[model samples]
Target: MSAGTSQETPATARGGLFVTFEGIDGSGKSTQCRMLADTLRARGLDVVLTREPGGSDGAEEIRRLVLEGDPDRWSAETELLLFTAARRDHLERRILPALAAGQVVVCDRFADSTRMYQGLSRGDLRASVDQLHRLMIGHEPDLTILIDMDPAKGLARAKGRQGSEERFEDFGLDLQQRMRAGFLALAQEFANRFRVIDGDRPMDVVAQDVLDVVAAALPERDGDAGA
Candidate 1:
């Protein structure tokens, strides 16, 4: 389906919840996503916790190219294409299948990240990003949890992380601040499917907040064999 098209059937029609988390780096989206997946699984809901840029084997390879190289390894447009490719692979190989099997797919990040990161860095390519998305990948999650936090705090946390995947984080704080604004704006643009969570609080507290939002929105399983 094209990104511009909307499916009429509820997300649950496919037998799963497509939940994606978005935020500026260090907003703790990955942690919260994992927590929600584990919590739901414990409740007897089949859950598939995954991440973007590297969910499936193909995407993971693309992820390494995009995230582990020099900061300027790819131009803004090229980087966008790479991210789009990864997302397509993730959807085809992991997300769609898991959802079709009636499992909750909690993705660490999704298209919104692409929109924000690219728009913030490239500035003039936002429209191209949208156009590309509509043409190549037009699916959105049933629910998107956006963890909001200060840019300074988020940048610090992200820098402290262990990994060579610091390409985006290497943009420094200015870009992250802009990305933060971009994400908040997106939350407003796609309000129906987005729940903005304050990520500045204690980890457990933020986790519960995530749980609360998800609990209120998760669809009933109804004994779906696929689940």
Candidate 2:
């Protein structure tokens, strides 16, 4: 086992498990994160449901700036900084506290989205954003679920609910395709910490699969491998 894997042995680790969900728009990550949290809570574990870019109060303000602001007002680097700022507040105020209390933290989106969206979308900002991620989050998630889906399908679903596209969502097909590739590559690079799910499946089926993966990833439930 590698050093990182050795250190992650559940028998020796006392911190709460931090799991993150990642994918394109309308990939059903938000729903699945809630489902997984509910499942873990049912098992008598304390669970916290949170999201990136807006978990904490300060982060929410930044989220508005990034998501609702005029497109001409912010450059890619500026957008990246806003996200990093939100992430810093989220980690300091929410995530770390919940983990310290031994509650499982299931985030809808986290650092990986930054890499896939900002890094892959902008290209020039990848290194800086990654450096900020390492400096802010310190530790990677225990497990990251990448809900892989076709861009066209995902965007159609997002449009149905959102009605209109936000700046990021309005990036069109080319950017979404690149974002999907970026996520897959990141998953491959971090195999032990990543799992890819077929997002085209029905919501309940996808949720069940995510639950199974989460169950298998937990150290204490190793015996219940088929959950």
Residues 11-42 of candidate 1: C-alpha lDDT, one tens digit per residue: 56687888899998899998998888777877
List residue ranges in candidate 1 displaced over 4 A: 1-10, 222-227
Q: Clash number for every model?
A: 4, 0
Best candidate, TM-score: 1
Residue 127 displacement in candidate 2 (angstroms): 1.3
How far off is residue 111 in model 2, in Å? 0.7
Cα lDDT tens digits for candidate 2, 1-227: 32233332231154677889999887878888888888777777778999988999999888877776354567877778888889889988998888777777899898788887777775667777767766655557888999999988877777678642266777667777888888998898778888999989888899889988887766573324334
RMSD of 1: 3.3
lDDT against the true structure, per candidate, is: 0.83, 0.78
Score candidate 1 by lDDT.
0.83
TM-score of 1: 0.91
Model 1: worst 10 consecutive residues (lDDT sum): 1-10
